[model samples]
Target: MLIAHRKKRNLWPSEVYRVKFIDEAIITVQSGDGGRGCVSFRREKFIPRGGPDGGDGGKGGDVILEASSQKRTLYFFRYRKDFKAKNGAGGQGKRKAGKHGDDLVLEIPPGTVIGDADTGQVIKDLTKPGEKYIIAKGGRGGRGNARFKTSTNRAPRFAQPGESGEILKLKLELKLLADVGIIGLPNAGKSTLISAISSAHPKTGSYPFTTLVPNLGVVKTDWGEPFVVADIPGLIEGAHKGAGLGIRFLRHIERTRILIHLIDSSSIDPADPLMSYKTINKELEMYNKELAKKSQIVVLNKIDMPDAKKAVDIFQAFAKGIKIILISALTGEGIDNLKSKIVQSLDKLDKLDE
Candidate 1:
């Protein structure tokens, strides 16, 4: 059982590591049922032949799903799968209508795709903040004896019963929505770079974690809108073949407009500096041709290490057509320049799109 802490503020990148990262879930939901109507008649002393005065039944409550920006995962539905709205109150005597049932609202993270569990069809795509949709509507209230009373039959004996609510099985899948995605092989300084760029504080080691989850961060700018960046983890030699949780991480970056291909200078081989780069790109092309065609910003990190400059020079010589940025992420050398370049690239893409 995965427990999700739905906090008041947005989750910092550090908390993501401690908590289990869940992107998919299945649950059941139900709407409220209508209340039954009451049966009564006017039996006053002055009115010997009083007409029927029964009240109408109240309407049932609806089950609503609301998208919230505060949430980042479908962990809310981990434990409590079943949800039901309040049933409407029954109608009372003396033409008193019953109380309406309350609405049930469920908050989910933005970029969540809702699907019908039984039919396997997409129900709705909640990509924007505060987006809402009525997954199931409550049943209508039944009529009362007074409403059924006619000229010939002044006193109806019985009242109508309440209607049943709707029942549905739902499937939820979450995809990260970010303007920029950082991709690289293990120990490519991705975690360190993301931590430097954003508020993410992922574990930085010599490729320690067996399953490193993706970390998301927001880069605030002095000008223009704030853009989101995600550190996509788990891309290996055979990522397209679902090697080592690679496919899962690959899909997360599909929505990104630009990709930051971070390369470790120390890991580069002077004989074949482009080996790693070509391997990663080949995997991307195999998985999805469009992913390979997406815009990329090649960055060479860890220039402070020994032989790093030599390897970078070799890569620069071989990869003449492409431009690359050299930086030492630990020493913060050329970080600001890298950020400006990212912003510039994004701005250019935006202009071309316009």
Candidate 2:
């Protein structure tokens, strides 16, 4: 029920992809095969009949996934679906052991969760910057015939063969890792607010679906404390049911600690401001009840309009008990006040977590 971003790639302001949460991806990984054992018999002039001498086989390679903070998308995995590792070498005579195989390393963005595609069980969650997880283990090497030679059997003939490596079909899904998520309907000034507060430049217009993907920014308050903010694409009615561009982006909001719901004050349906507010909340509840319960701040944007008072009155009457702030992203009016409230809210949330 999800819709892929249909906007032409060139139409996007930045060619750099801003994919935040990837719902599904399939990966086929193959470990290297174990090497074969050698077979030989010692025949010397001094010793009439010497014992058998067979070398052991080497182990197969492993496949690994490392969590990296540099990567932000799973798009790289889309093209290369197959992953393979090297095989170990066989052992030689004189009880020499075989060489072990090399391991293959894959780097993924932080907050990525790995799951088995077939079984649907959660394998690992990559939350830290440099966390490492082994997706598939390598095969064990075979024992040499010399190891089998004992007091009872001085001339062992056969050596054990190496075990085969593991093969897995895995799926990688990404969850948005930001501290805060900005949500609102199209043209509600979500992008403008982010641009005003941080350095992220998302395409802005009066049209809907201007943003097809999530955008991230680092906002530093006057106190010099920095917090990560994500601008998720707009959500419309029935977004939880996969009605608009919002359904594809709703998952990204799951990782955020707070939600800032923005509303356009200049909207014609003076009551449209509050309607937009309730519709987003309904969609959130439909998709995830816990997401709807998260801490939220209702923001009435573009307050520089002449009819701003009407929007504020309607929102205040309908959405009571919810903290609401009025601001103009263009003129930067009341931006500092908004920042203060956000900082205070974050401080409280952090303390509660502690």
Candidate 3:
């Protein structure tokens, strides 16, 4: 006896990747078509003649996008390029209207922005959960012959045709939302600091780009109020011009309430640290000046190194009035002080709202 073999499909990776913001994805959305109207006459043995009894047709389904806080990435729709809704049912005789088509609901990550492929103008920015936006409206149903029956025209020969469904080429972009964003070059100890403060475990390595996807950590201050922090991927030179992974993840920092720029003090050339800082700032200004205007904090990492001791002093002298801190993520040096300062800043912002 011959046995049929069952094939196993590779499951999608649950492991998150540190994705840059500049990638482009195309999605084709089609609304359901309206059902056709039915033309039928009602006749009974008792009643010889009955007025026009054709029922009206049902409306087509619509395409809707809903924001979900639980979803952190748009990877769900990455493979599925096509999205469609169900069509409405047709009408029947004796003034019975057909059922309307079911609406298609798409759950997307918070901070998702929808835009038209042609114009590139943003349609909706989904900032809050449960927020919904209609990208494509369903077509209207056609009227039946019964609707056309009037005093002047008693008998209508034909019924109106259904309207055409809407078709749109759409694009969705996701930007992470957090109270604070940590940015720096790869291996700058961003992952270490986040791991020290929160439960999020971002991949850490001696090599570059160990943390592929943005990592969110919940930092609870002394008062026990928790705030969110996001670690953006490493950005290299020419990131504003789409060089490397720089362009892909810059937008993720756009919605941050505050920016914490981490710098590595232990480097081959001491001046290279400051230069990297300036390069990242320049790239931020080039991409969006408003990003440069957001609140900023400068941190010098790997201060436990003997060579980094004097470098921190020199860096502080050049930092001028900007708030700067020396921290050793591996040793947990100055981690509490940094957390306190972050809480102070967040507290001030909250008080302002009150």
Q: How many residue pairs clash in each candidate?
A: 0, 1, 9
- Give the per-residue lDDT digits (tens) of candidate 2, residues 1-354: 123346363466643554432334789887866766656567678988777677777888888899875555564686798998778778677666788889898888777889998998999998887899878887777877877889998887778787788899998988546668999988888889989987577888888888778888767677534567789888999887777776787787797889998888787365354677778899899899999999898888998988788768877877778778999999999899988888788878766855
> In model 2, where is the ten-residue run with the lowest total lDDT?
1-10
lDDT, model 2, position 6: 60
Q: How do the candidates rank by lDDT, highest first? A: 1, 2, 3
Model 3 worst lDDT run, 10 consecutive residues: 1-10
User: Which of 2 and 3 is the better model by lDDT?
Assistant: 2
In candidate 1, which residue ranges exceed 4 Å CA deviation? Answer: 1-176, 208-211
Task: Report residue 182 deviation for candidate 2 (angstroms).
Answer: 0.6
lDDT of each: 0.80, 0.79, 0.76
Clashing residue pairs in candidate 1 (N, C-alpha, C atoms within 3 angstroms): none
